[model samples]
Target: MSRAEANTNSPKRERIKRKKQQQGRKDHVEVCALIPVFLVSRARNLLYSHLMNSR
Candidate 1:
């Protein structure tokens, strides 16, 4: 491998790494946001099922 090739590739690789990190963070935040919604829906379903059974 040539020094110039490594030099050119390193900056591009660094940029891609930064972009990937940002995307990962965004995905994590989306998952965090959805957790409460998921829990609420799950709880609602369980409540409805229990009420139906009690009827």
Candidate 2:
């Protein structure tokens, strides 16, 4: 490809990459916030199971 074409494409590629990274970051933050809730629910179920077994 010509140098001019390459230079034009570079900015477009960078913009796309930046958008994807921002989306990924948002997803990660949402998942991170939910992780503790998931773990707590899992632990609660485990405890409940043990209590039921002991009965």
- By TM-score, who's the top model here? 1
Residue range 1-55, candidate 1, lDDT tens digits: 6999999999999999999999999999999999999999999999999999999
Candidates' C-alpha lDDT? 0.99, 0.99
Question: Which sections of candidate 1 miss by over 4 Å?
Answer: 1-7
| Per-model TM-score versus the true fold | 0.72, 0.58
In model 2, the Cα lDDT at residue 44 comes to: 100
lDDT of 2 at 14: 100
What are the root-mean-square deviations of the candidates from the true structure over C-alphas? Answer: 2.2, 2.8
lDDT of each residue in 1-55, candidate 2, tens digit only: 6999999999999999999999999999999999999999999999999999999
